[model samples]
Target: MPRGAVRVDLNISLDGYATTTDQTPENPFGHDWGRLVGAYTATRTFRARVLGDTSGAGTTGVDEAYAEAYFEEVGAEIMGAGMFGLHDHGDDPDWRGWWGENPPFHVPVFVLTHTPHPTLEMEGGTTFRFVDTDIEHALELAHEAAGGKDVRIGGGPTTVRQFLAAGLVDRLHVAIAPILLGRGIRLWDDLRGLEAGYDVVAETADSGTIHLTFRRE
Candidate 1:
């Protein structure tokens, strides 16, 4: 079988910003975070997988289709320290993550951080492994843990940008929310003409969010 592909799923604003500076100690995610991923989190797939809501209470349209694809065929995940809630909770050694006891990822999760922490095996099949190394080494470990399934480059924007800059990503999916967040980390800052080698597709969801998918040629 072919080695699983490297993928990234992210939510950005109309201006291409992926992060905001308004995040306070009280609200780690900041105020505009929800607006960015509102359409995505409202999908049935997200409700069932992330929110653990099985009552079938969410949209099942274009956005849902991408949301469903996000979880499918992913065997291992790689995320930044902030994505794992490390930037804010680093002081707390027992702080598992933002997802509580059982995270949504039911696979090996490689967290890119500077510190060396013990492997945290969570409730589901998910196990958190911190990699205090380069991106290539992290990808190697993730691919090994994936066991032939796809390796996901889970985001915090900066992490995703690194993979994209290194040209290691196979498939890139971004849900473009309509909200205008004037101040934040822009996703397309220096990565101009990134759509050159990829087959791109754009679809507007019922919720006005545009889903853009880029598959390497």
Candidate 2:
């Protein structure tokens, strides 16, 4: 039997916006706001486990702690096509991969997309597989590839909403930033009237973000 779990990890403004209205290349976020995600992505454990690099060590105590807690058990990842850039118009057919030279997810990554694309093999052990079926199909594929380890649901709000609304997500990790974007993508927008509920499993706050974990009840 394949052992895996799905969890959402994202940073959002206090007013609830993952990215600003103009989600173009010029302004990824609105108004140069919020803390840089680089710091969170630079953790030693995060680098080693996700990026397949040997460098990096515990810098900030909190950062190191969160890295250890979140990344220790991940074996696979599932993401939305928007997060993987499948909807982006580009000449290169292989332009869907998230990280350029080296992506952070070293394990199998199942990307949810409407169009069927070939599987992408990147440096290290990461392979981005496009799933044109549905969120449940992607989860099943992720679980099959994960062996006995956990499967992380890398999000773009819409994808997370699909899973949450279906009651398929087992866990969620939300990092609420202190800044506010006023308008953009929202985490709870699509899940407004869902009959699902999440029980708080853990909560923590830092200078830039507040981390919260939830388990379906």
For TM-score, the strongest prediction is 1
**Candidate 1 TM-score, true structure as reference:** 0.93
Clashing pairs in 1: none
* Off by more than 4 A, model 1: 24-30
Question: Candidates' TM-scores?
Answer: 0.93, 0.82
Estimate every model's Cα lDDT from 0 to 1.
Answer: 0.91, 0.72
Native-referenced Cα lDDT, model 1: 0.91
Model 2 residue 130 CA deviation in Å: 1.1
| Model 2 residue 196 distance off true place after TM-score fit, in angstroms | 5.5
Q: In model 2, which range of ten residues has the least summed lDDT?
A: 30-39
Worst 10 residues of 1 by lDDT: 184-193
Query: Can you write out model 1's per-residue Cα lDDT over 33-102, one digit (the tens) per residue?
Result: 8889889889999998887898999999899999989888998999999989899889888888887788
Candidate 2, 129-187: lDDT as tens digits: 88878777778888889887888888877788788888887787676766666777777
